[model samples]
Every structure is written in structure tokens, then in C-alpha cells.
Target: MKYSIRNILNSRSKANGNFFMEITKILGHKPKNTSIYKKAFTHRSMNIKDSEGNAINYERLEFLGDAMLSAVIASHLYLEVPSGDEGYLTKMRSKVVSREHLNELGKELNLLSLVESKIPSGQFGENIHGNLFEALVGAIFLDRGYKHCEKFIYKRVIIPYVDIETLEGKVISYKSLLIEWCQKEKKTFDYNVYEDTGNDDVRHFSVKLSIDEKVVSKARATSKKKAEEKASKRAFFAFQNRISQFK
Candidate 1:
């Protein structure tokens, strides 16, 4: 069991080789710079730094990937739906790259398994999956350029999930929809949120959605946003016939 720098280098090379294969399968092409891909999955908790003493993590890549995703999706929607106006195109692109949809894509790829983090993966929030997926896109753009990045997005996002008719019907946020409807109908709506004690381990918030000074629906969730959204969904259904008429 004698150890040397050569043995350590060999071990690391073997690990990177396996990683390269995995990335290739995901990208549909070999990555030019494996180190960029490595940085994509490196969590801030690791406190990694480059030789220049600059912090290294996925956050920066996440921002870049978000922009890239938006640009590519917007371009696709623009060409695909020549009839769509600015608002329609914007909404369609949002649906295509929504947090929920991105999370699903990340889960499908199992990208979290590659993360280099000091924190346990289980402790991460649901957004971590989507974050990693975006970071991977940023890495692809940096390593292989926009052509490869656009191709990857088309394969993973546009080809499988994107359908003009389907996306038009998709609701990205019930809360936003509810609010818009309220405003359009000239109805004053309020979300009254308060902490709700529960036997479950997680703290909960209860929300009452009131429209026209009448309590329309009530719901509870671990977060106020979720609680309000749940209540809004219930309220939406409650007034579905009227809302449909407005639309």
C-alpha cells in the first residue's frame, strides 16, 4: 500500500474520466474542459477558490445559464410562433424555463449526484436541482460555446417538453393568475397569512384569500407563498366559470 503522487494523480484521473463520460452522455457530446463542468456542480459551501483567489462556485454560472436559457427559449418562441406578441412570447418562454419545469429536467438528469458540496445533498432545497441544471448549461456555454449550449437546451427542454398549444394553456403561477384576474375584474383581493402551529416537524403558514371583502378560500402550507398559492388555486376553481367568461 505504498503511496506516491503518481498514485494520487492516477486516482483523480480515473474519477475525472468517469465524470467525463457521464457529462458526455448528458450533453450528447464530449466536454472540452472538464474543469468547467466540475465548477458547475461545486457548491458554495465548499468555499472553493481559483489560483487568483477568486471564489468559485455555481452561483455565477447559474446567473449566466439563466440568461442563456431565456435567450434561447425566447428565440425559439419568436421563430416558432410568428403570431405571438411580446407579452405572449414572454409568457411562453417563462413557462418553458419555469423553476418547476427546470427542477423536473434536473431530476431527470440526476445532476445533483455530481455536486461537490460540504453540505449534505438531502438538506438542499428543491431549487438546488434547478440551480445545478442551470449551472451545467452555463458550463456548456463556456466550454463548448453558444451553439452547443443551444443544442443542449433544444434536446433537453424544447424538443421533449415544449409545445406551443400546450405551453399556452400551462399556468406558471396560480397566484399571479389570481391576482391578474382580480385586477381585471376590479375586485380587491387580499391574502391574510399567519403562522399555524402543527404537529408535523415543519412550521406551517395558513392563508385566507379574500376577494371583495369575502373569504373565498383558505389553505395551509410550510411557506406563506405555497399557502397563498394553494388558496388562490382553490379560489380560482371556485370562481372558474366567471374567470373563464372573462378570458
Candidate 2:
């Protein structure tokens, strides 16, 4: 692959003094090991490799960050809602760390502005925001250990967003809600999804959500799962009153 001046400049920009300042602002303190943060924002598309020939990218860090987030959020839910049993606590934690929520957090911070990727930013999907957020958390854990990581999570995530009552009503998957309601009501539900090779390079899928042999809602998305979910959400809203009756 060829490298343009823009790509070269972008790589150099990651290490400049101003970049650290921007990071310090988000982290609420100066970072000791800036390279980890650099890794956090670096996308796998760059194909960077370490001296040991190990791939150097944010994916591993994202995994670590996800675990840390789960642990911290679980602890918070455990203490805050003493009466909640295992199932309730698990669901609450899932709501807090849901992809949509993390993506929103990353976007609110403008974290993607710091990312280094071979592909244009326009090509990246919404999940990139959450991926970067998780990688940043992992970098924090590596740079300053759990205490600093916890502090950053609380400041950025928990204190600002986590609310017990609000979270209780939050729906992580409208598809799950619709399925539960259907099962309870003894109604059959199905998502008929088909590949939609549109003009665009990205493959798409179209879905028709059927309830009791009647098509209730239809949607199209980049993936079958998403298409099904979009259709399910629409169907849920279409029958909102009926679905809510199960509550």
C-alpha cells in the first residue's frame, strides 16, 4: 500500500505535544505512557506491528476495557441496589455498558477525532466510537492502574449517565422485548431477512417482521441482525399499547 503525505502527517500528529494535552483534558490528568493511548486510538486497518511481530492495535485493549467496565459497573450496581438479585444486577449492568450507550459516550467526548486509521473516517461504522472508548479505558488501566481507570470511568460514565430508575426502563434490545411479549401472548413472531445487494459496496439486508402470519414492520440495514432489530423496534412501536399491556 502507498502512503500519502496526509497519512504520514497523521501518524506524526499522534505523538505531538498537542495530542497529549488533548488527552490530558479527557483523562483529567497527564498520561505517563502516551504510547498506550496512541495504541488506543490506532485502528487495526493501519496494520501496525510491534518489534516482536505482534500486531499492535486497539482490539486487545478494547477487550480489557470491556472487562474493566463490566467489573466497575457491576460493583456499582451491587452496592447501589442492595435489594437487586443476580438477574436484576446483570440486566442493569448490561444496560449501563450497552453498545449504544458507549457509542454515545465516545461521540460526546469527540474521541474519534484522535483516531489513526488507514481508512477514511467516513468509512467507519458507529461501533468505532465505542471501540475507541473501550481501548481508552484499557490504556488508562495500563498507564495509571485500576484507581485512575475507575476514576475516569466514574467521571465519564457512571456519574454522568447511570441512573437506577432510568436504566430500569431502558431497553437494550427492542427485539428481545418484542419476542418476550409475543411468547407471553402466545403469538408467533418471525423476521424474514434477505440480502439486498444495493448499488453501494456495503452489502445490506432487508427484513420483514411478521407477527401471527401478518407483516407488521419492515426495515433494511447493513446486517441481517440490525435489519431484524430495526424491524422489531418498528413493530414494537406499532403495537406499543398491546405490547405494554404485558407489563
The clash tally of candidate 1 reads 0
| Poorly placed runs, candidate 2 (over 4 Å) | 1-15, 170-247
Per-residue lDDT of model 2, residues 20-99, tens digit only? 89899998778897778878888889887765567778999999999999988888888889999999999999989999
RMSD of 2: 11.1
Q: What is the C-alpha RMSD of each candidate to the true structure, in Å?
A: 11.5, 11.1
Per-candidate count of clashing residue pairs (backbone under 3 Å): 0, 0
What lDDT score belongs to each candidate, Candidate 1 first?
Answer: 0.83, 0.83
Candidate 1's TM-score reads 0.65
Query: Which lDDT tens digits does candidate 1 get at residues 30-59?
Result: 888777888898799978666566777899
What is the Å distance of residue 182 in model 1 from its true position? 40
